[model samples]
Target: MSGADQATRERLAEEIRSLRARRERLVDELVQSSGPGDSGDASQELQGGDEVAAIDERIAELEKLRAGRIDVQGVDPGTEVVLRFSDGSTQTFKVVAIPEEVLAGEEDITVTSDSPLGLALAHGQQGETVRYPTPDGAVEVEVLSIRRPS
Candidate 1:
C-alpha cells in the first residue's frame, strides 16, 4: 500500500471512532433528560428528548457498521485489481472504504471491504481472481497487486 492510502484508511478508522464516541455522549444526555417527567409540558419535552435519542441511536448504528471492519486478510491495502464484466470489458479499481464525499451516493461502486466484490477480493492474493454474478451476468475480476492506497 502507498503511504497516502494507509494514512487515509487510518484517518477513516479514527473518524468512525470519534463518531461513535459522540453518539454515545448524545445517548447518555438523552437518557438523563427523559427521567421522571411530571406531565403536560414535561411530557412534551420528554417526547422531544425521545426523538433526539432515536436520532442518536441511528447514528450509533451507522458508526458501529463503520467500525466493524472486514478482514482484508491476504489482500493488502493498496491493491490494483480489475473487474471484468460480462460484456468482456474490464475496469481497474482499487478497493477501499466509501469516501466521506461519496458516502451519500456511489456507495455500491465505492465498495466497502465487507461488500460482495470487496469481500471476495479481500484475502485474495496476487494473480488470483474471483467471479461474481450481477444482474447483467457473471463478471470475473483478477487481482494484479495489493498495497495500501497511495
Candidate 2:
C-alpha cells in the first residue's frame, strides 16, 4: 500500500472508533432517560422506546464492525474490489466495515467484513482465488483487482 492509502485506512479506522464511542454514549443516555420507576408520560415513554430501538440497531452494526476489525497490510476495509466468478462473470464491491447510510440509494454495492465472502476476501491479493461454502455448495471467486477509492 502507498503512504496515502495507509493514511486513508487509518483515518477510516479512527472514524469507526469515534462513531462507536458516540453511539455508546447515546445508548447510555437513552437508558438513563428511560429508566424504570420514573413517572414519565406514556407518550414520552413510547418515544423513548423507539429511540432506544434505533440506537440498539446502530450499536449492533457498530459491534459487527468492531469484531471485523482488520490490520492486514493488504485488502483493508474501504478498498474497492473486483471479483471474477467461475463462469467468467465479474462484480465490483466496496469492502466496508459498515455500510454507509448516505449511499443507501446508490448503485454501489458494499460488503462487510463479517460476511462470508468478505471474510474470505480479506487480506487477499490480486490473482488469488478464495472459496467460501454456501448452503448449496462451495463457491470460488478470483480476486481480479483491489483499488483504493480516489
Residue 44, candidate 1: C-alpha displacement in angstroms? 11
lDDT string for model 1 (1-150, tens) is: 123344454655676677567657766766676767567747766665676676567556545435544334433444556665446666666555434323344454455454567667766666777865668776677666545455
Q: What residue pairs clash in candidate 2, if any at all?
A: none
lDDT, each prediction: 0.57, 0.65
Stretches of candidate 2 exceeding 4 Å from the true structure: 1-75, 100-102, 106-108, 148-150
Model 1 — which ten-residue stretch has the worst lDDT?
97-106
Model 1, global lDDT: 0.57
TM-score top scorer = 2
Q: lDDT of model 2 at residue 47? A: 72
Candidate 2 lDDT over residue span 43-149, tens digit each: 56677567667756765654544454434332456778899999999998876544432144443467765567777876678999998777989999999997854
- The clash count of every prediction, one per candidate, is 9, 0
Name the candidate that leads on lDDT.
2
